[model samples]
Structures are given as structure tokens and as C-alpha cells.
Target: MKLKILLFAALCFLSATVIAQTKDSLKTELPQISLSPVPVEVFAGNNGVSFQLIVSKYFKPDSRLGFFNVTQFTGKYDTADQAKNELMSLALISFDIWKGFSLNTGAFIDNYGGFSPTAGIQYLFANKDFLIIALPRFDLARNYNFEAFGLAEYRPMFTKNWGFYIRGQAMYNRNIKQDFLERSYVNLRTGVTYQNFQFGLGYNYDVYGGTFNSNQHSFGVFLRAELF
Candidate 1:
């Protein structure tokens, strides 16, 4: 009887140990998510001072599937009517299709385009010195449009705490049915960076109108930083 009681107690202890180990293993295998920082850029040009705020977030439940969202607001203080202000936002579910490409299906919203069911392919590449993103999407709305947007940044370290920063962003949107260019713009910036803050020169060339006759150019200094 004593031997049987000891054996029973030992079996119970073994079972509890195995269950605790399994729980620990499952906890370690669960995916962890972290929030990204928001970045803000302000460019003071010859025409006016413009402010831009960008927020991007990503959630990866596992390795193969993820969710992404990006919202941007850009406004120029040159006009009282807020004629040049723009806001664009995107929410997407991303599937990892290849090494650096993701198949994204989402919705896009902007001031000019309104709400659109968007389908796009996103490519992202980032390393210590360079970051690049390119997305080409079609807006499925009345007066459907095809839009291509790209952003690239290069940073080379001069010291441990300072670096040279250069960035370029461009966007082209065209109406597919009407066969006209809706909007296009090229922006370039070069500056010095200390940690997450940058200060430098900036240039902008913008084209408006369906006929693409109206054009605006601006050159000035800019300050950009990331907010945690």
C-alpha cells in the first residue's frame, strides 16, 4: 500500500511538470508586436511653410500574414483657404508573397479621391543605410484612377551620432477612364541628421489640373523628426 501511494504521488508530480513546461513553450512561441514611431516633416519653402504628419503601424500575428495602416496629412500655410492641403490614408491586409514583396488588399481614402476600394502591391526594402517603399494601386471608384507612389531615403553616417540624410518622394495619379493626369508631384530633401532629427534644404515641384498646365515650384529649408 505504501509503495502504491508513493508511485501515485510521483506520477502526479510528473504530470504537473509536463503541463507547466508545455504552457511555457506555448507562451514563448506566441508572436510579439511592437508599435512604430510617428514621423513629422515640415518644409518652409519660398511659397509657404508646409507641415506633414505621417503615422504607420503594422501588426503581424504570425510570419505569413500581417496588417498595415498608414495615414498622412499635408497642409500648406500659404493660403487661407487651405487649397493645397491633402490627406491620404490606407488600411491593408498584407500577405507575404515573396522576399520583399507583399500582396495587399485594402481601402484608400483621400480628399480628392474620396473613399476607394484599393488593390495594390507593396514592395519594401530597408537596411541600415537605406529605406525604400513603392506602391502602385488602382482606385475602384467613379472616374477610376491608377496611382503610383514611392519614397526612398538614404542615410550615411558621418559619426556615431550624426549622418547625411537624403530623401525623395513622388506620386502620380491618372484617371483611367477619362485619360487625364489628375495630379503629380516630386519632392526632394537633403540635410544633416542628428539621431532621429533632420534639418536641410528641400525642393518641390507640383503639377495640377487635368490638362496639367498649372505648375508650382518651391525651394527652402526643412525640419523633420520622429515622435515616439
Candidate 2:
């Protein structure tokens, strides 16, 4: 009930914002789209794949609207511990308010079948060789948790056809009402890039729960490609 109300309110707010902009804006440009088609990471006991899509268009020189989505699925290959298998997704609608800063509203669906409606602020920077994003949000459901996510990637060219790639990503979610950490993770990747593909080594450390927490460390290789 409350989640539905919050979702409705967010949709209304975004619609009003877009309608207001279109009233004064010249024209809407065609959206630019980017996709990562099932990037895979292979680990000793767990293997995972992730898919991402982003679409953005400018309504004015200083303002734009975008949609971002990410889906992750992991499987445990060595054990029957279904708890170690996970599926999660995040989807957001973002509206630029200032330079590299945006207001975002979205939903996060966790592996345990929990759905959280989230409202947040995000900062994004991207160029030919660098990309960075930082987001802090509040969960509108389930004790109103606070969540922060960050990602940074650098791909600098060593020659016309080769480049070095490194990326770091992190996420932390805390149940503020209960005064406990719900989930946290850090992921790192480094390797070389050729054309639109990247081959890399990856490491991830994940912790779940509050005082009696369970953690996991995974090291693996990964392959990623950009599909524009």
C-alpha cells in the first residue's frame, strides 16, 4: 500500500517535470542507447552474468532525461546451497537538474524477493576514457533503509587498438530504523581492452545481514563488451 503510493507519487513527479520542460523546450532529440549484453564472470564456485541498458536524450541544452537498468544473476555450481544463488535488478528514471547531477526514482528488487521503491540523487561523469557514478537513496519500504552505490571505470588507450581497463564498484545498504547493516559489497576489475570488448580479472567481497553476518569472497575472470 505505502509502496504503491510512493511509486505513484514518483511517477507523477517525473511526468510533471517532463511535461513542464516540453512546454518550453524546442524539440526532443532522439535518444542515445547503450547496452551491455550479458557480461559474464566465472568464479570457482559461483558464476554470474549481468546485463545493463541505458537510454538518454536531451530536451534542452542543460536538461535531459534517462532510464537506466541493470540485472544480475548468479549461480552456485559447486554446492546445493541455493542461498548462494542470487538474482537482483535495479531500474531508475533520472532527470538532470544540474551539471552531472540528477534526481532519480527507482525500484530495487533483491535476491530475497524484496522490492524497494527508492528515491535518490545521483552524480554521473563520463567521457571517452572515464566513467563514474555515485548514488545515495532511501528505501521507501521495509524499515526505510539507506543505500549508497558507486562505480568508477577508467579505460585509457595505450595505442590505437589497445587500452588498459580498471573499474571499481561498491554498494552498501543499511537498515536505519533497525540500526544494522543489511548488505554491502565491493567489486574490482582490471585488464585490457580491444575494440569494444574487455578481458579482465575480477574480485568481489560481499557481506550480508546484521550482527551475525555471512560473507563471501570470489575471484574470477570476466569478459565484457559494449553494444551500442
Candidate 3:
């Protein structure tokens, strides 16, 4: 756990440099569609090491709404080698409810995680170089109830060809009748973005049932590309 914290700190250090750099006064637009691949390490839960591959897509129909899809495939080895997969999708609608603050809501569905209605808010600060997002949802499925997640990203462009970026995501889930944390997931990453290409190293963790219940941790490297 200590090592994982250190890795997260390293990513944040790169982001800290952005505070000293000049910020872009103009808002930069994103692509209409983007596809990226994320690979991570899987430790514990299973008896041996494993790898998880996720293919994700981001689509924006307009400035106010966006949609996303993620498919995951996992392979592992233990007493018996096995593989599993899941598909999750989301739709978000953005609103300018307050100054420097944005609100969005829609629905999220997953093959294994269950279907859930979700709402979120985002705050952009530090010359628009830093962003924070909070999202919460309730799964309609009988298996689970409430869940909340948040994401933070910091990107600072040093030049036309060089830039640094740090991103972190975490989620907490619980059952309807019970209080206290039930399930959790965390992802932390930091790397350099060169034009449309990105390379990074990070850690991934998932826990089910309780805080220290059945859980898995992984540290690995990932590469992403933006092809509009």
C-alpha cells in the first residue's frame, strides 16, 4: 500500500509543475470520438498474476452531452486458469448550474456491475488545467445499492509536442440495507502526452464486499492514443 501511494505521488508531482506554467486562456475542444486501450496488472484475489485489458470509447454528440463504453477482458492462472469479461456503458449530460462548476446526469449499465442511474458534477480550476469530477449512482439491481466515484486530471502542455498529465479515479459502493463501504475501485496514472500519443504507469485496485475483503492490486504500464 505504501508503494502504491508513492506511485500516486509521483504522478502528482508532474501535475504540480503545471501550476508554474502558463495556462491556456481559451478552452480547448475535444474530439467527437476517441478510442483507447488500457492494460493493468492484477494481484491477489486470484492465486497468481494476471492481466486485464480494457477497450474504451468516448463519444460526444454535442457540447452538452457525451457517451462512453468500456469492455474488459481478464486472464488469470491459479489452480485452474480462467478468463472473464464485462461491458459497461455510460451517458452524461452537462449543465452549467453554477460558475466554474458543471453538472451532469444520465445512466450507467454494466454486464457484471449491474445497471445504475448516475449523476455527477465537475469543477475546472487553475486556468482550466486542473479538473475534478464527482459522480454517484444507485444500482437498481437487487445485488447492490449505492455507489459514488470521483476523478481528477491535470494536464499542462509545455510545448506543441510535449505535455504532462496525471489522472486518478476511485469508486465506493455499498448495499442498500447496510452501511459502511462495500466495494471499491481505484486507478491512478501519470505520464507524458506527445501529440496524440500517451504513455503512463499506474496502479489499479478493486475490493469487493468490505474494506479489506476480497481484493486485488496491480501495478503496470499503459499506452493510449487519440485518433479522431
Candidate 4:
């Protein structure tokens, strides 16, 4: 009788341990989602409003192969009349093709525009707090234009909940008729963040609207929130 009781207890312990392990593994397989509001100068002058939503899932526990979808809107602030400049949605797959580098290939749709293929590369460092991405593509079928876009960002933490970040992006486009269109735009931003919220100020220069000698400056106030 004593031996039987000991065997029963041991079997129960093993079953419980296996169940816990399975639950943990399932949690790791789930995807992560984040949403934020990223206002821009193009919509409401200095008060333009934009939003972004991202959903990503890793193929394995090590975050090597990942799939993501990003959607964004930019234009004038919310209004009953026309208040939007552009709407963009992208579906991308990112893979750690080599050490310290990753490759991204995706399809993007612009403002009800047809789908356009995109391929880019990311250089990640400093535990992914610092990143540089470049995407240059030609939209020959729909827009008949060649475009190049680049973004650079750096975020360094001072403490657990405090940090600073600097980010910038540039875009250039050219069509058959013109060497470069008036669509060129550049923005530089720096700000302080607490926890998942960021507050900052930035400057935007619109090349299509003015020349460098008479460049137009758009001062912008920005805030971001991380909704998981």
C-alpha cells in the first residue's frame, strides 16, 4: 500500500509539470500588436494628425523570421470635408538573412492606389534601439515614378522609464517628365520619452513647396503612445 501511494503522487507531479510547460510554449507562439498616433506636418500644418497600427509575429521563439502589417494615414486633421493627404498600408516579411542585417520584402498600397512591390534592408544595432532602413523602388505601372526613401532612428535609455530619441526620414521621387518632382520631403525629430509615451518637437522642410534658399519650415509637436 505504501509503494502504491508513492507512485500515484509521482505521476501527478509529472503530469502537472508537462501541462505548465505546454502553456508557456503556447504563449511564446502568440503575436504582438502595437498602435500609436504619429502626427505629421502635412495634414494640419503644424497640428496634423496621423495614426499607425502594427501587428507582428515571429516564426520561432528567437524572433528570426517575422511577418508584419503596418497601416498609416496622413493628411489634414479630422474634418467633415476632404482632410486626408495619403493612406498607406503595407504587408511585409522580415528575415534575419545574415548577422547584424535583415531583409524586408513587402507589398504596399497607397491611397487606394494599386499594390506596389517593395524590398528593403535593415541594419539593426544597439539591441535594435538604433536602426537604419532604406527602400528604393520604381512604380512604373501605376505612377511611372522612381522613389527612394530612408529612415534613421536612435533611442537610448537613461533609466528604466526615461530615454531620449532622435529620428529622421527623407523621400525623393522622380518622374519621366521631371528629374525630381516637388514631392520631396524631409523631417528631423528629437524628443524625450517616459515609459511608452513620447513627447517631442521636430522640423520639416518641404522641397516641392520652396527652394532651399527659400525653404518652408514646419514646426511640429509630436506625441506617441504604445498600446499593446
- Cα lDDT tens digits, model 4, 1-228, are 343335435644654564455544534443222122232222224635554454445555566566655565655544752533557666777755443344566776765445777554443333436656565544424444455666787878899999997878777755433434635667777898788776788777655421322344567766666554
Model 1 Cα lDDT, one tens digit per residue, 112-217: 7588886667777766788787877676565667778888989898998899999999889887767788888899999999988989999988887664357789
Deviating ranges (above 4 Å) for candidate 4? 1-47, 53-57, 68-70, 77-84, 120-122, 126-129, 138-140, 176-182, 206-217
Per-residue error at 117 for model 4, in Å? Answer: 2.9
RMSD of 1: 16.3
Clashing pairs in model 2, backbone N/Cα/C closer than 3 A: none
Stretches of candidate 1 exceeding 4 Å from the true structure: 1-37, 67-72, 78-81, 211-213
Tell me each candidate's RMSD, in Å, in order.
Answer: 16.3, 5.6, 11.3, 17.0
| Model 1 TM-score on a 0 to 1 scale | 0.75
Superposed model 3: Cα runs more than 4 Å off? 1-86, 100-103, 119-128, 140-144, 178-182, 210-213
TM-score of each: 0.75, 0.76, 0.59, 0.60
State the RMSD for candidate 3. Answer: 11.3
The most accurate candidate by TM-score is 2
Clashing pairs in 1: none
Q: Which ten contiguous residues of candidate 3 have the minimum total lDDT? A: 25-34
Pairs that collide, model 4: 43-75, 43-76, 44-48, 75-85
Q: Rate the local accuracy (lDDT) of all candidates.
A: 0.72, 0.69, 0.52, 0.55
Q: lDDT by residue for model 3 over 1-228, one digit each (tens)?
A: 343335435534543443234234212333322333332323223233333333223333334233332233344554343432324455555443333344445666654456666554434333435655565545433443566767676878899888997888787777654555666678777889787666777777867664335677767666656544
**Clash pairs detected, candidate 3:** none
Lowest-sum lDDT 10-residue window in model 1: 26-35
- Steric collisions counted per model: 0, 0, 0, 4
